[model samples]
Target chain A: MTQTLDIERELCGHAAVGEAAVTVDGDRVVAFVVPAGGGLSLRELRAELGTEPDEFVVLTALPLAEDGQPDWAELSRSRKDLTRRRMPYTAPRTDTERYLAALWEDLIGVEDIGADDDFFTLGGHSLLAVRIRMRLQRDHGVTVAPEALFENSVLSEQAAVVDRTREA
Target chain B: MSQRTKWLLRDPSPEAEARLFCLPYSGVGASVFRRWPSHIGPLEVCPLQLPGRENRIGQPAYGDFPAFAADAADALADHLDRPYAVFGHCMGSILAHALVTELRSRDVRQPERLFVSSSRVPHWPPDRRYRMPAPGAVGVYHPSMTEEQLADEVSRVSRTVGGTDLHPDLLPLALRVLRSDLEMCFGYAPALAPTGCPISTIGWSDDADVPPAEMGVWQECGPVTHHVLPGDKLTFLEAPAELQEVVEKDFRG
Candidate 1:
C-alpha cells in the first residue's frame, strides 16, 4: 500500500511546486520542462549550462514535448534583464570556493584544504554542513541549500557545479 | 558615552506608557530584540547592546558575570529615570534579576516588572558540561565525524532550540562565550542577594538547553509566574509577538 501510494504521488508530478512534468527513468530526473517562472530564470538557467541561449535553446526545448511537461521553450528572451537581476552573485569565481575555504579552516584548523578533497571524506557532516551554509550566507553573502554540500562534496567540484549552474 | 555603539531602537511611541529594557543571551547581542516594539504597543523598547559584538567589537568582553552585571547596571542607571520594566533571556535573565538586586542595594527605584527567559534563578549551577577546546583542537568532540554528521547534530540541536543551522564562523565565537558562561554558572555558589520585584518566567516548549524541570529553581529567588509557549524549540526570536504581549501585560498588571 505504501509503495502504491508512493507511485501514485510520483505519477502526480511528485507534487513539486512549479515543476514541469517530463519522462522519468528509474531514479533519474531525466527530461524535465522548465516551468514558467517556476524553474530557474533564463539568466540563472543560462549560467548553469555555461552556454549562450542561441546555442542551448534546442537542447533545453527538447524536454517540453513530453506529456504533462511545461513549455520551457516559450520563455521570452525579453525577460532576460529581469532574470539576470535575480540570479546569484557572478564574480567569474563560484561562492563554493570561499565557503569551502572557510569550512576547512573552521573544521580541521587547517589554513587551506585542497579543492579536490571530498567534504565528507575530510570528516564533514550534516551539522557542519549547515554551519558551513550558515557561515557562507552570513559571512560571504552566498545562498546555498544544505544539499549542495552533499551533492558536490569536493570543493573544486562544487565550484564547477556553481559555475555550471550560472551557465544554466 | 564616547564609544560608538550600534543600537537597534524600537521605540513604538515617544510618549509611551512605559519603557521596557531587554538584555540579550550570552554570545548574542541586542539586535535580537529589534522587532519587539512593533508587536507590543505603548512601550518604549530599549535593547541593550553589550560589548564585543557588532559595532562594539573593539570593546573587551566581560570576563565574569558579576562584572558584566555591574557594568550593565551602572550603564542602565541613567536610563531608568522614567517608568520602566526589565527583561532578559538566558544569561541575560539572571543578569536582569541580579541588576534588580543591585538597584535595591544602591537605593534606586525598581522596575515595574521583570521578565526572565530560558534561565534558572541567579544561584543555580548550570547543568551542561564545560569542555572548552584549546586552540586548533577540533577533535575534542566528534572530531572524526564528517561535515554531514556535524550538520545533522547542529540541525537536531537547533530544532530543539528554534534556530537554524549554526553559522560556521559564528560557531567559534559562540563556543568562547558558552565556555565563559558555563564557567560563570559552574563556579557560582548561590549568594544571599534578594529582590522584591514581581517576576515572570518564560519557557520554551522544547528547550533542551534549559529544561522546564530545572526552571522551577527560579522560584527560590522571589515570587515568579511561569508561562510556557508551544513550539518545536524555545527562542525569543521565534515568538517575539507572544513574548512582547506577555511582557506588556505583566508590566501593566
Candidate 2:
C-alpha cells in the first residue's frame, strides 16, 4: 500500500483539495476524498483518473448519492471508452497551421487575407467582429477581445496569446 | 465608357419608362444590387459602384459626403440619357438625396422617383448615443466574450443581433469605410428644400438598428410613402417579392 503522504503528492501541476486524501494501490491511484461543496463532479473526477473506476472506487459525497451508496459499476460503464485521442490538457503543436486552419474555416473570404493580417484591416466591421469572436470561443474555447484583434492584427500573435492562456 | 468596371445592367425593354439607379449600403459594393434588374420590371436598373471597392479598389475612397455624392452625380450624369429614378439603402439613401440636389444645382434632369430604405430623414436630430466603434476597439463590434459573454453583452446592447468572424486582412479597409461613413452621417446638415422627386421609404419593423418608428422620420423628405415589413435584420432579402411589388407600383405610376 502506498502511504497517504506519498499519494498526496501534487499531480498535474494542480494541488489537490485540502480535504481530499489520495490512496494509491501500486502505480495507480485508487480513490480520493473531496469536500462536499468543492463543485467537483464525478465526470471531472473520472477525467482526472484518465480512465473510469472499477467496482472498488467509490464516492461518499451526499450530493452524489442517488438512493443508497453511489453505483460505481453503472458509472464505469457509461464512461467513454478510451481511444487514442489527445486530451484537451495536452499541449498542441507549436506550428501555426492548426490555428490558421480554424481561422480560415470561420472567416469568409479568408484567402484574401494574409496570416499576419489584422482583423480590421480586412474589412471586419463591428458586426463581423462579433461573429469572429463568437466562432473562436465556440470552436476553440478561447476568449479573444475585439480590441486584441486590432492590436495584434495577426494569427501568430493571437495564437500565442491563446496558447499561453490555455486552461490546464 | 471609361473602362467599364464590372457593370451589371438590366434593360428589360428598350422602351422602359425610366432608368432606376440603385446604390448599396455601408460595407457593401455595387454587387449587392446586381440582381435588382430582374425584379424591378418596366424599369432599367443601373447599380452604382462606389470607389475603393471591387474593381474600383485602386481608386481612392471618397473622404466625405459631398465628395462621394459629387462623384456619384458625375458618374451617373453621362449614363442619364433617359428619364431616371433613384433608389438607395442606408448610406446610399443619403447619397441619393444629395445626388438629387446636385443634379438640380447643375440643371440636370431629376429622378422621377426617389426610394430611400431603412434610413432616417436627413433633417432629423441625429441620435447622440449611436457612436461608431473605433477602428480597433476590441469586443465593441465583435463580442469578445464567450457564448456566455455574448449573451450578457447582447442583453445589454439590443442593437447587436448576430455575430461573425471577419477576415483579418479586410479589417483595416472595413474600419476606414466604417469611420468615413459615420463621419459623413454625423457631420451632415440636412438641406431645407425636399427634392422635387416623389419619395418612398421602406424599412424592416424588427430591425433594432433602424426601427420603423425612427425610419418613419424619412417622411420629412417629401410626399412620403412608407412601407413596413415584418421580420428582423435583412428582412428585405427575406421578402424580395413584396419589396419588388412596392417598387413596381411606385415606378409604374
lDDT of 1 at A24: 28
TM-score for each model:
0.51, 0.50
User: Candidate 2: where is the Cα deviation over 4 Å?
Assistant: A1-168, B5-17, B35-39, B128-164, B237-239
Writing each residue's lDDT as its tens digit, candidate 1 over B91-110 gives 77876777777777776667
Compute the interface RMSD for each candidate structure. 16.5, 18.8
Which numbered prediction scores highest in DockQ against the true structure? 1
Q: Would you give me the overall lDDT of model 1?
A: 0.52
The TM-score that candidate 2 achieves is 0.50
- What is the lDDT of every predicted structure here? 0.52, 0.52
In model 1, which regions exceed 4 Å deviation? Answer: A1-168, B1-14, B127-167
Model 1 chain A lDDT-worst window of ten: A78-87
